[model samples]
Target: MSLSIKQQLIAQLDRILSAKLEALAASITSTQESRDSDTKSSAGDKFETSREMAQIELNNLENQAEKTARMLNELKQIKTTSTATIGYGSIVNTNHGTYFLSIPYGKLQLDGTTYYVISMASPIGQ
Candidate 1:
C-alpha cells in the first residue's frame, strides 16, 4: 500500500537516523580498537593521550547513537493520520514553507519536497 506524506517523512527520518546510528557505531568500534591497540611508547604521555582521546570519541559516538535510536523510536510511535492543527505529528504549512511539527530537526528534503521538521514546543511551532 501507498504511504501518506507523514509516513513517508517518518520513513525518511528513520533512514537518516538509522544511518547515523550505524556510522556512530562504526566510529565507536574503530575508536575502541585504536584504544586497545595503543601502547606505551618512548613519547611518554602520548600513549595515555591517545587512549583518553579514543575513550572520549567512543563515548561521544555511543551517546549520539543512543540519541538517534531514541528519535527513531519516537518516529515509530507517531500516528500518521492527524489534523491540520499545529501539534505533534502535524504538518504545518505557511505562506513561505512547509513544516513537520514533531522533532526539533530543522530542514529535510524528500522527493523534491522541502520540509522544516520542528518541535511542537518550539516558538515557530507555537
Candidate 2:
C-alpha cells in the first residue's frame, strides 16, 4: 500500500531520531570507558578534567536527545488526514512561508523551490 505524506514524514523523522539516539548511547559508552581508564591510571587532575569534560558532553547530548525525542513524540501525537492544515508530518506552504512538518534539518528542495525544514512544534511551523 502507498503511504500518505504524513506517514512518509514520520518515517523520515524516525530515521533521524534513531540515529540521534544511537549517537547519544555511543557517547555514554565512551564516557564510561574513559572514566574506567581514569580510575585505573590514577591520573589525578587530568583524570578529573577528563571526567568533567565527559560529563559535560554527556549532559549536552542528553539535552539534545531529549529535544529530538520530544519532537518525535509530538509528531506521533498528531492525528489528522487533511494536508490542507499544517500539523505534525504535514508539509505546509504559504505565500511567504514554506515548512516541512518534521525536525528542522535545514533547507530542502521540493518542486524546484527551497523550503525551510522545521519541526512541527517550532514557531515557524506553528
Candidate 3:
C-alpha cells in the first residue's frame, strides 16, 4: 500500500527537524570556538563583555539544540498510519486547507499538497 498523507508529513517533519538540529549544533560549536579564541587575547573589560555575550549565545544555542532533539525524539515516536480521527497523527482535509495534527510547525508542502502542521491544543485545531 501507498504511504498515507500522515506518513509523508511525518517524513517531511523529520527532515526539517533534523536539519534544524544540525544547524543548531553547528552554531553552538562555532560559538564555543569563538569564545575560546577570545580567551587568548589580553584581559580587559571589553574582552570580558565579549566573552560574556558569547557564553550567553552558546547557552541559548545549547538550549535550542536540546529542545530540538526532544522534538525530534517525540516526532519519531508518532505513528504515521493513523488517520481515524482529527487528532494527533490525523491528516485532515478541511475546506480552507489541510492540517496534520501534531506540534504547531507552520506550513509544509509535499507532493503538490499544502499542509498546516498544528497541535491539537491550538484554537484552530480544536
**Who wins the lDDT comparison?**
1
Off by over 4 Å in 3: 1-3, 40-43
Model 3 poorest ten-residue lDDT run: 80-89
TM-scores, each model vs. reference? 0.89, 0.70, 0.87
In candidate 1, where is summed lDDT lowest over 10 consecutive residues? 79-88
**Which runs in model 2 stand beyond 4 Å of their true positions?**
1-3, 40-43, 83-89, 95-97, 101-105, 108-115, 119-123
Q: Tell me the spans in candidate 1 whose CA falls farther than 4 Å from its real position.
A: 1-3
Candidate 1 local lDDT, residue 89: 87
**Candidate 2 lDDT tens digits, 1-126:** 113644655665677777887887788778767766666246678767877887788788778878777766776776545655546656666787766666666675444656576865677776
For model 2, state the Cα shift of residue 109 in Å. Answer: 5.9
C-alpha RMSD of candidate 2: 3.7
lDDT by residue (1-126, candidate 3, tens digit) is 134666777888999999999999999999999999986456688899999999999999999898888877877877756444556767777899988777778899998988888878888889
Query: How displaced is residue 96 in candidate 2, in Å?
Result: 4.4
lDDT of each: 0.82, 0.67, 0.82
Q: Largest TM-score belongs to which candidate?
A: 1
